[model samples]
Target: MTTISNTERGAAKVMNRTDLTQRLVARLHKDEAVVGGIGHTNWDLWASGQRPQNFYMLGSMGLAAPIALGVAVAQPDRMVFALEGDGSLLMQVGALATIATVEPANLCVIVWDNEAFHITGGQKSLTATGADIVAMARGAGLTNSTWAADEAHFESLVDEALGGTTGPRLIAARIDMTKPAGTTDRDPVKIRLNFMSGIAPPDKEG
Candidate 1:
């Protein structure tokens, strides 16, 4: 497994979260399922576009990747993406090991590392003190983990992940602490039903 050094990560272009979220959403031509982590992660997803396949995590801190893993496992033909924040991902880093163990070919986890818990009062996260998420992910056996170098590089990684058949890939981006463009509607029931309906196979007439 190749290690991505801190110097390489420091060279990555710091980008705005909302812009990247929109970019990712725009690239989804298929009915790909996106599980957005709590706080601004989900807010940006909601702002990108109200896709029925987008599931927002209203209260959870670190369940986005796990939920996406379940979705990928259940629907092997569908691609799944998990958008998680640095702080939130650290809350359940174990999920990375589990995801690696399962090796869901269609699953991709994108970490927006802004170095702070922006939504929860902007407290500096461990990432600010030198915790390398991509390195940790690789250590957990996700050899495909990498830190996106810039906007174009991020897009290229996403495209590659979407096109590849071997995955359980992890992409970490150094992001700016910009506020989300909008807030997700706080209706868990509706969100759940919408996501289910969105990803469900079409009904066949007898």
Candidate 2:
């Protein structure tokens, strides 16, 4: 078992909050898709906005992957991106196995590995274990796994992952756990509405 402290990791994927959100939104800008997020504030920012797409999350930290698995299995045709933090992913890794078996090609696990739980006071996280994130996905029977910390690489991986045959794909986007910049917990009503929209019949948008 080996680990690399944030200090040792050096450098991080730096992008303005809005820019990051926009970039990710572009990737996941599809209706009938269920995107699972892990962080409260970050997820809230993506949710509270006019996403127009479907997104749900486990705001309490960890559990994003499992939720993503559920959505992907339920909606195998549409894509499901699990935008999660390294700390959150560490908390509930067993979901990886469930995802592996479900084999939903529409599911993509994008881990914003910042080495810490940004919402919880930016404390260190298990990602420091420097555990090969890509290997972890492979161990869980996921293909199309890679890691990126820069804009160019991330863009490429996103395209490739989405273009692939699907199933479970993982992208460990290396970033820093900076101060939280997002909204408060979401309204349960809106959450349910978004989910309903994901699976609702076409004539039921009202």
Candidate 3:
């Protein structure tokens, strides 16, 4: 197997979260489960398209990855994704280690590193000062981690991850500070019901 280091991925491209989210959404054909982290992450996922397989986190800061991890573990055959902001992921960095320990082949984590808390005031984040999330993930044992250098590369990584390359995979996308186009519906109960009902096996009736 050929191994590529994070630096080998090339210089990180500053991208738009909305575009990245749309790219990710367009590639979903297998009813993949997507967990959106709080604020901008879910907002972009919501703006892209609201599917039953998409779960939007309302108030939680750093739970998207953990929640996706659970979903991936429960449904071992389904592709699961977690879209989280850099600040939120920093809040729960330890989750990366936990995900590595589980070693779920179907789990993919995407961190939108905008270098600031875009949802709140645009405060400078650790990443702005040169923190490398992909490196941190690799250190935490998610060796498949890589930084997406550009849009095409991002699509390729997403395709590979969804195609069942040994995961849990983590992709760190350096993004711009533009605001999301829309907001997610603030209904946690409906979100939960819909996501659960969506991921339910086709043969099983709820």
lDDT of each: 0.91, 0.62, 0.91
Query: Which sections of candidate 1 miss by over 4 Å?
Result: 1-7, 203-206
For every candidate structure, what is the RMSD over all alpha carbons to the true structure, in angstroms?
3.1, 5.4, 2.5
Instruction: Identify the superior model by lDDT, candidate 2 or candidate 3.
Output: 3
- Model 2 worst lDDT window (10 residues): 1-10
lDDT of 3: 0.91
What's the number of clashes in each of the models? 0, 2, 0
Candidate 2's C-alpha runs over 4 A off are 1-18, 32-34, 44-48, 58-60, 198-206
Global fold similarity of model 2 (TM-score)? 0.79
* TM-score of every candidate: 0.94, 0.79, 0.95
* Pairs that clash in candidate 2: 3-129, 105-167
Question: What is the C-alpha lDDT profile of model 1 across 1-206, one tens digit per residue?
Answer: 22232426778889999999988988999989999999999999999999999999988789999999999999899999999999999999999999999999999999999999998799999999999999999999998888988887888788878985877899999999889999999999999999998899666212
* Cα-based lDDT at residue 104, candidate 1: 91
lDDT by residue (tens digit), candidate 3, 1-206: 22233543237779999999999999999899999999999999999989999999998799999999999999999999999999999999999999999999999999999889986799999888978898899999999999887888888889889887686999989899899989999999999999999899777656
Model 1 lDDT vs. the true structure?
0.91
